[model samples]
Structure formats: structure tokens, C-alpha cells
Target: MTINRLISGALSITAALSLGFAGATVATFTAAAPAEAASTAGGQITRSEVLARAQFWVDDHVQYNLTRRSNTLHNDVEGAHKYGPDCSGLVSMAWHITANAGKGGNSTDDFESWSGKEYLGSLHDLKPGDAILKSGHMELFAGWKVPSDHGQGAWTYSLNGGPDPDGDGWQDDWAKGPTPNWKGKRGDETWSGLQAYRPIRYKNIVDDPPPQSPPAPVYQTLGDFDGDGKKDIAGIAGDGLWIHRNTSTPGNFSTSGVFISNGWRTVNKFMAGDFDNDGKDDILGMNYGDELMIWRSTSDANSFSFQAYKSLGTTWGNMNKVMPLADYDGDGKLDFAGIADDGLWIHRNTSTPGNFSTSGVFVSNGWRTVTRFINTDFDGDGKADIIGFNGGDELMMWRSTSTATTFSFEPYKSLGPTWSYMNKLLPLADYDGDGKKDISGIADDGLWIHRNTSTPGNFSTNGVFISNGWRTVSKFIGADFDGDGKDDIIGFNGGDELMIWRSTSDANTFSFAPYKSLGTSWGNFGYKILTSAPTD
Candidate 1:
């Protein structure tokens, strides 16, 4: 017996076989793509439409080898209709998940963060619209080859051409085939024969069964990517993003960053804050269209992730410098402070978790005079305070004193001519292991560290210097990259080199080990949109 096929570029394959890779069109296929999947609330898609979408590729003979190594080939690129032309791309499209910033398709890692996706532990639990997945592969489950044969085999549709009769390892499928779901795992995003293929069903994939539970998210601090209670270094290049997990030991990170998702670089600007007070940090994205969308963090034990973004607001066409702050007005929801319209504005989060709140002016006439400002608790008043340097290089502290929506501020203290030497402020953390908020910044020659004294305004006694030759580092993000409870600094040169200045300090002595190289080819795409992740 022989099977004839149409491949890309009209290539025809004439192969003689007994039960080869090719099979009849799936039984569930509907001739017309149904509208049911496209109109569901909460972005849900129906099971039949998922099948119809998957069948379109098989019918149209999508080769499935274009795994988005290049932006042009990926659905993220504008007008990429192939839906990424890869296994994950096919799933991303068939499942109706958007690529977000890229405007195309989701990568495999993105499934972790997206809300409404559920994991089916074994083959017996899978349904027609369910996906069989590991780290690097995915298959649209059709049904059992035999109703009782699930223990041995089941039917599936996949891209990334397969049919490894030689039994070596995974390769692009010569054509989309009825690749049987197998037992095993693809630990490092690679799968050979039956390597741990588990099942995942989208929470909103309907017409089959109701989900067992709602999506539960793992929470982390603003800078923590993996939700391990330790902040990690994360960033994006092109459509891809990586999370460098902190090993809990100072200066140690997982050599290979855990891939979190794709299409991150598409966000115009990112902000880090938990709008829902979930303890886990959620993301706020500003796109080129001046629209603000929020992607609630949904990280799991495996990777850093977020739920699909929902519209928060729009018309933010002019924010020169913006930082998302949690409850600056003690409103219990997210708020943001930024320098815009020649003044400082406080945009409050909406009463509901999913929409934009109102915006109010915090300082109509004084923000321009402050050369630089940072949000911290310098006065230890149990509320976030503002620390900024005035035109006279006067480092001033404004204690947040308010009992209502109209919060007021008073000049708590000032250390004249102290902060002028430090050109930039690091993230507010206890850098000296003193349990008190300290301040650090970058200067012309190197980095400076100042301790918080018992008194306000006079933060330190002339502080101390950590390193000298920091003239070339372009980006500095102070975070607890290691879970050691002390903050460390990560620096990136103008090029690809990423180095970390691990803190080696106690109560008062300021010190850090020499910069240790994290890796190269970091900001190759000229993107500083990440924390140094992109969530910030």
C-alpha cells in the first residue's frame, strides 16, 4: 500500500507503507470552523472549534517546522498567518491563545502562566480538545485509538513533523501524524521516545467537562520571578524571555535560565506591582497604542508565568518616567507614580481587579524640582515614603502621612549635599543585612552604599564605596538574586556581558565581591524593557 501527500512548495511524497505516519482526517473534524469558540467570554474556546482549527493546518498541509527561531517566521511578527508553524504554535493558535506583545502565538513556556489551563496527570484523563505536552512538544488529543487502548496508545494531531521509526529522538515530523501519546518526561525541553508526555486542558476549553478548580497563582515579590521567596534576574530578547532562578546562596543562579514565555519584548514598557494584593507580583504593560494591560502573575513550581492580560485602561500616551507602586494611597489596590505633564501623578487601581482606576495628581508643581525620587520606608512609619534629591543635591525624605484617599506628605528630614555624588538609586532593600532600609546608588567612578541611621534625613555618616571602575556598566537592578535575604546587584554592559556584584556585607560595612560574569549575548536585541525581567 502507498500514501501520497502534499508538502510545502507543492512537494509530493509517494511512499509505500503499512500504517505509516499519515492517517485519515480526524473523526471530530467539522467542515466549517464553528463560531462558538471565537465568541466565548473570558476568552474561552470550544472543543469542536479547536479540532476544526487544528484540522485546517493538517488539511492545508502546514509543515510545522517553523518553530519561530526568527521573528519573521513566528506568529509574533505582524501578519504572520502560519501561527508559528511549529508544534507549540499550532497549539497556541488552535487553542486561541494570543501572543500578546507579538500579536501572534504563545510559546510552550507560556502555557504555565496563562489562566484556565489545567494539567491532566495521565493519558486516561485526556479529552478531544486536550493537549499532550512536555517541555518541547505538544499534541492535540483526538481520542483513544481503541476506547480501552489508552494504557498503550491514543490518537493525536501534531506539527513539528514526527515519525521516528528509527527510534532515535524527536525531529520535525515528516508530516502531521497520529503520533501516539507516550509515557515519560522531557526534562530539559527535549523529548525522544515517549518522554514524559503529560496532558493539559485549557480551563476555558469547553463542550467537554468543567474544570476541577480555578487557576491558583504562586506569589512572589516585585522582583522575584520564580516565586521562591527569592528575587531572580529575568529579561527578554525578541519574542523570548528567560528567568534566572536564584539558588538561595548569594551569587549562585541556575546556570541555564528557566524559559518563562515568549512575546515579552512586544510590551512597550513594563511595570511590577500586585494590583490584587495577592502577595505575588502582577504585571502592567504599556503598549505602543498607549493601552495598559495587566497580566496577573500565575507562576508555578516549574516556571515563572502570568495569566492572559486584561485591559486596565488606555490613553497613557505620555509618561516619561513611571513606576508601579502598591497602595501608595493606602487604597489596598495597585497605584502608580510617575513624572508626567510636568508634575507627579498618582494613578490608582480600579476597585475591581481587572480594570483601570482613576488618576490623580500627587504633586502639581513640586515634582519637577526633585531631581530624582525613590519609594521606600526611610522613616520606618510602616508606610511607604518618598526619597528624592532636590536641585541643590539635598536628599530629602517625605513621610507619607494620610488617613484617607487624599494622602498628605511632610518634609521628614534632609541631608544636604549627601546624595549628589550618587547619580542613581538602586531598588530599596536591606542591602547591609541590617533589617533596616539602606540606600545605594551609582556614581561617576563606582557604586555607593549608605546605611540608614536611627535619625531621619541624615541617612548615613558619609557612607562607603563598594567598587570603583563601574563607569561602563549600563544597567543596574538591585534584587535578591540569591535567596539569602540580602540584596545583590546585577549589572549589564552596553553589549551582551551580564555581571553580578554579589553583596558581602554585614550591619554597617559596605562591600561586594568583584563582578562575576553571568553570561553574554544578554541585550543583543537592544532591549532594556525587562527588570534587567521584563515584568518591571
Candidate 2:
């Protein structure tokens, strides 16, 4: 896919580190596009096209993965290869179908195996018959959907990411509006909320590569998620630390709860990246006690185990914001970084839990209401830096030096115009990969990915993805949803379902392809989805 050029010198070290995938080697890959023309869409994607693609695939692969596609969530009967349709499995089936639409072959065998790195790049380029993934499964970007209002419209996709991700006809409670409430309460009873739609245009179609070859088993751990023998994954839902198992014929999963809070039932955030040189992926979760809980995998992949070591105490500081993991220290181990209501806090790894120390903290010195946060080094120094928002016009930055314990200064990095408090930033590797880190932020207006080409303490902007009338673009997370190595944006609309936006022109800039409803619409209330790759 075409991507905006990221200036090498201007990017901050933290920003650059954030873009580095923990394990993937950084290849000198480059795209042929300038900063300004990244998000230009040649046409729109439609809902009908997505449905047709999903249906076609499911119809063809009515074996193995899609063998038993009933409209229920029960156990598989004897000899039923694909009994129940869960969220990811369904999407897996759908991607298999869409990948080999016309070519004659077993749908499951024809589709490529999932690859977190390769898929991100392919889907972001917007290939005609590509798939976007949520986790183990995937969804197709049927096409773009341009409504009467040019920017305000739902994306269309073949197969949803929820129960019937493979478009096997099975649906979930969320797919139906007025989804069951937390208290078993029903809110809305509408079916239209989860239906797919279609767009009119498609752009930047690329040749589909042969499916990715699965990586060798690096760590043969027992509680392997994806059953790949590698214990590189860590996840959290509403619960504590868990491992996903994809080996079981319908895929089995298990939770360790090693990092769970003692009394805290609700979990706010969960992420995994190699936090230490330990090889095994470390797990972190935020609890109700304003505590930051950590679990380290001490041994190789197979012998997975943990003990709660670090806790951002109630007295110390509570972190409720999204926590991003990266090796900011350049030590090859990912560090824990995030923002809270009061200030920015980072826990650098000592490689040992309980002994984990704070990187630095920038309080709400001048600006109040520090809610959301992002970690990036705006300047091209080899230190991890921080960026975030407050209830003010200016954005905040805390720049760290090579050996500094705390960041220097520059509270408000002016964005010129007033910014809606709900702005979200998705910082990818040098969209230019010029050794500098580039960033993409989202707001009510549209998407903006810019290359910081100036020196430290200076401010600049580059516009990549921009649309004026995007109605309720919920804060989204960037992941290679379609299994392409290129990062795609997954946003739940003001409605119940989540929309998949694939970058047609650039790695950061994307066009809207309304995906199937995530499942049943839970409620019209706000929901946040953080995508973590789970291998199979």
C-alpha cells in the first residue's frame, strides 16, 4: 500500500521505538507516495459486495472450518469438524472464502495462514480480495460505502468479526440491537444495527501473495495461545491474564489469572510484547485499585507461569488509560507506558517484577483532565517519550533523554486549532522508515498522520487521512486486522458494530469499508476495542 513518507530526523526516539514490532526485523521497506496524497480514495466500498464475498466464501468452504454453520452457540456434534461458530473462527472461514472466490480449491486450504506482520501490510494496501483480521479470524473489506454525506457512512464487509465472522449465518446477541445489558437487561431489539453495507469505490489493489508460512515454534510452552507452541501472546478481556489455544478443533483457550487483582473484578487494559530479554511475552493489566499488575513469563514458551510483582498502588498512582508496550530503553525488552487522570507514568523494566520502577511522571502541571495517553518520541533521540491530551487546546509531550529519569519539559505542543478531547493517536513505524517515527491521529473531523520533520521542541503537521463529516468515529486501535503487516484502523461507530477502515493508498491512510457488526450491538453506549494479535 502507498504510505506517506516519514522524515527520518524529526521523529522522537519514543515514537520510533513504538513503531518497532517487538520481534519482527525492520526491513528497509519503502512505498512510492508523498505525505499529502496518502488517503485519496479512488472509489467507495459497498455493503452488498462485502456480504456477497463473505457468503461466497462460506458457501464454498462448508467443510472443516465452516462444516457445521448453524445459527446457534452450542457444542459440536460428533464428526462435525466446524461445529459452533465463534467470533474469530467465523472470520477465519470468511477470509478463506474471499481469498479464493473464483479459483477452485478447498476454501480453508486455499486461504493463507494468518500472519500478524505480513497481513498488516497487504490489507492496508487495500488489495481487491484481501482480508482484515480482528484476532485469529478475519473480515473482508468488501468495498467503501460513500453515502449522501461523503464522510459519514458505515463500512461494508463480508463476514462480521463477531459470532458469524465467517458469514456462516450464526449470529450473536450483540448482532441484534437492544443487546443484553450487564444485568441481563435488553436495550433495543433491532436487526438493522448489525447489517452490512457497501461503498462505491476501491483503490490501490495489489497482487495477493501466497499465504504466509507459519513461524517455527520458538518457545514450546504449555499454555500456548493459537497452539503454535510459541508463548509470545498475552491477552485480557474483562478478566485477568489468559492464553488463547487454537489447536483444539474449534480452538480452546485458558486463563491463568496470575496477574489479576485480588479484589478487583473488572480489568481495564491488557497487552503483551517482550517486556524483558526473557523471550516469553510479558503480561500487564490495570485493576480497579488504581494498580498496575504485572506477570512475567520466567521460562521458555512451554513452562509458562507468573507471579504478581508490580502494582501501581492506590497511593502511588492509578492508571486507567491504554497501556502501550515497547522497548523504549533500547534494551530489547518492552516497557510498560500509559497515562492516567493525573499525569503520565511509565514503568521501566528492571527485568524483574516487584522491582519494576517508574520511568518518569509528568503531572497535570498546567493542564487539567489528563485522561488518554500515547507513547512516542517526537524527536529522533534513542529514548522513549510520551504524548497525550488534556482538556485544552494544546497537546502534551514529555521528552526523555538517553539517561534521564524524568522528562524535560514542553507541556502543551500546540496543534493551532482547538482539539476535541477525544482525539486518538496511532503511531506506526517511520511511515517513511527514515529512522524517524511518524504518527496518525483521529478526531471528530477526520484522520491525520504527519511526519515530524523539524527539530525537538518544534511543532509541525502533515495531513494523510482527512474527512470533515465523520459522524461519531469512536477512538480506534490500529492493528493489521486483515493479517497484513500494515496497520488498519478498527473503529466502532456511534452504533453497536465496529467498522474496519483499510488503508488503500498508504500504510497509515485508509478508506472506509464498513465491516459486519462485531456481533450483536451491546448498547448505544460508548465501547472501546483494543486489538491484540492471537496466532493459530
Candidate 3:
């Protein structure tokens, strides 16, 4: 038989200034809560702060004690409070929920009682910083070692920290020795009997920081919307998104379908990214209302479009000429940037996936003049950077700094009267399969390709003609319509037709395999814009 010596409610903690656990030397500690943090009676909290507070114990090696023992009393973290040194106390302190003057946190029974409305479907739906509880023990959810798998088991943060973390063992006190509690997980043996584990979230847990000064946003990169592992041609027209799936043979479109058909026509442009971290491309764009919105993608192909959505922000209308999409902070969360009247403005994403705050600004000025703006990791620093071209025929790059919260401008090159007519810049895949971004631009005369160098922002080859005699095309997008690793070029020619000129060679040279029409009379679908989902 198993037993868990759980603590009851309203623990009467003594201010043992010198008396430590098991007769040690440390005092009972109580950390001051964060400013504006909620009390134990239940107020709102951010997922980040909850996880942050949990780490503090692991860092200080707070020992687990069944007796009415407090951690410490300091205002370093929040609300000027402290928590008990037990399982429920650890979670309650992590959640900033302690009743009766912060003497002790909630009990196992308290957590179990709260799980009725807080259960998030099941353990599979749990994200980081959530908790799983049974009668006598509870654990802070870290994640699954395999990202997509949940039933296998889970990694957790518990008060006992390690060894008998899953049991109600008579744990050793701090006087004996503190065990590391930060990086710990439960295997099958523990998880099987832990079937009563109730998945619960704090009542006030927000995806990002509380509504206040929003942090600078991070850019959301693109993804493969169709899950084909290859880029597909997608466009926004009227209220629906039209996707033309490319065949194994280039320029041959296999199918046309619509995913998102709600409120898309209100968007001036649409950009694709994995906003929910579900590993699929989600369509997002700012409407005239200034709201930063997202339509989450799912695993289902037939029912994936326009299923879930969120209007995360309302102040984004100020970012005019907006293409604010990229991961500027390397934090794995998508960031936002756009050219406002003053200059280029950026917002670093300080929240979780699919959530954002627009009040923050990374860079406030000095980028309005950049005409041809596009993003690529020119420095190959794992963070995407921006390259720009202007009527001056000069090429430049705005590099993401080491911090990734902002950028620095660097001049790249200039051609005297040569690329003066270069109106559009297309930085596509590694045409030579060399693992570097190949520079491709479109002129009124034809398409031009340049080989990027090993050095940052430097091109080794001159502008070579990929094709000629096609001045009817107005805009172009690069995507691998087929499941090929190589990216193919899709163009909107004559203002009404979508055409694909397939790549024929793998050498430094780019030749076409004849033009194929993907669609015609596309203008009938209203003012349309195009995007291609990326594999990475």
C-alpha cells in the first residue's frame, strides 16, 4: 500500500528566524511577491512569472519539509510573500497563491478541488508551467522529452526535487543536504499510477505578460501550411485563401483549395508563420482595426482552415507599410516589425506562441527610406536579418544584434546605374543547393540571380539573367510547389494570372522548364496577395 503524508489547510508557520529544518542554521524564508501579483484568494498571473518563481526554489535548493516551514521572506520576486517548503506549498508559491499572511500555500486537497473548472482537457493539452495533481502530490509541468508525445511520460518540477519526488517519503531536510529540483522528469512507473493526475491551470494564467508595457515583439517566420514539407503557392483573395498545390513535376499545380475564409479580405496583406507552435503555418495579418490577429492551423487537412483564431492586439494600425514578421529575438517566438511614418518599428515577442503585445517598440526610427525590404539571415546567425534596396541602386542590410531585440544598419554594395531599375527583390532558396540564400531580383526586362558569398551581406557572383522578355509580370513569390527541396518561382503576370516557371538546373545557373499557368482571372477574387509556406 502507498501513502502520502499530505499537509492540511491553514498551516501555522512559526517565524523560526534561526531554527532551520531538522535543526539546521537557516531561517524560515518568505519571499515578497512581484508587484501587483495576486494573493492566495485567486488573482490573475502570467505563465512566465509562475515558471520564474518555481525556478527560484530550484536555484536556492529549497528543501522539502512536511512541517509548517516557510522558504524565505523577501520582496525579490513579488507581493512580499513566502511559501511553505512542501509539495503543495511549492506549487502554491510558484503560482503566487498563499492564504493567511503567506505563512503556507494551498494543500493537495485545495489543488484537487480547484481542478474541476481548471482541467485543460487532458495531459496532452498541457503546456509548460501547468500542473498535474493527485490527492497527496502535484508537479509543475515542464514538457515532454519528445515534443509531440504526451502519454509516454512528462518532465516536472516538484518540491522534493528528486529521488522519491513522486512519493511521500520522509525527505531529508536542508540540514542534511538539499537535492537538485530544477531538471527532473517522471518515467512510466510513476506516471502509470499517477492516473489521477488532474491537469490544472491557475485561474489567472495569461499566455503572455499581463496587459502593461508590452515588450518588443519577435518575428514569426513562415511554415508549410499543407504539411507537404515543401513550399506551396498560397494567396489571399476576397474572403478565402486559395492554395495551389504543386505536383512532383515543377510548374504543374495539382490542386486548388481554400483554408481560411473569414476576415481575410479585410487584410491588406497576409504573412504565414507557426504562431501557435503547432508546427503548421498559420495565417496572420493586421487589419484596418490595428489588431494583430491569428488563425491557427491544425493537423487535419480537410478541417484545418479557419477553425481557431485570436485577436491578440488592437494597437498595430500604426505600423504602416507593414511586413512586420521575423524572429528578431531568437527566443523561438515570432516578432513583429513594419515601416511607420517615423521609420521602422519593431516589437519583440515577450509572450507565448500565438499571443502578443503591441505596446512595446524595439526600434522607433531610422528606417523609413528603406524601399525594398526583405528578411534573411545574411549573417547565418540563426536569427533572421533584413536586407534593403533603394532607388540609389545601393544594397544594405539591417542586422539583428546579438541581443535580437533590435538591429544595426550595414551598407552592402552599389552598382553605378546597373540595378537602378531594380524594383523588386526576391531572396529565394539555395539555387545551387549550397546551403546559402541566393539573391534573386526582378527587373522590368527579366529575372536576375546573384550568388551570395561566405561573408555576411556580400555577393560573389554578378547579376545573371534567369529569364528574359517577360515584362508583363507585376509580382513574384518563391515556393517549392512540388515536394522538392529546391524553391520554384511563382508570378502574378498580367494582373490576372498565376504562373510558375520551374527550375531545370541545379548548377549556379538557373534555367526554366517552360511556364505553366496555375490559375487565371484571379483578380475576380478581389484585391489579392500571395505567400508561400516554408519548410523551416
Each model's lDDT = 0.57, 0.38, 0.56
Query: Which prediction has the highest lDDT against the true structure?
Result: 1
Better-scoring candidate (TM-score), 1 or 3: 3
Compared with the true structure, what per-residue lDDT tens digits does model 3 show for residues 255-345? 5555545556666556776555545666776565677677666534544354555777677777666653666656666666677785766
Better of 2 and 3 by TM-score: 3
Q: Which residue ranges in model 3 land beyond 4 Å of their true spot?
A: 1-223, 245-253, 259-262, 351-359, 404-417, 427-429, 456-461, 525-527, 532-536
Candidates, ranked, lDDT: 1, 3, 2
Estimate the TM-score of every prediction: 0.52, 0.42, 0.53
lDDT of 1 by residue, 16-125 (tens): 21223244322222223342224322367677556655555554555445435444243311123436667777777667665442534666777656665788766678
Candidate number with the higher lDDT (2 or 3) = 3
Off by over 4 Å in 2: 1-264, 269-273, 277-281, 297-314, 318-346, 352-371, 404-413, 421-448, 451-459, 464-475, 482-485, 494-496, 507-536
Candidate 3, residue 485: CA error in Å? Answer: 1.7
Candidate ranking under TM-score, highest first, comes to 3, 1, 2
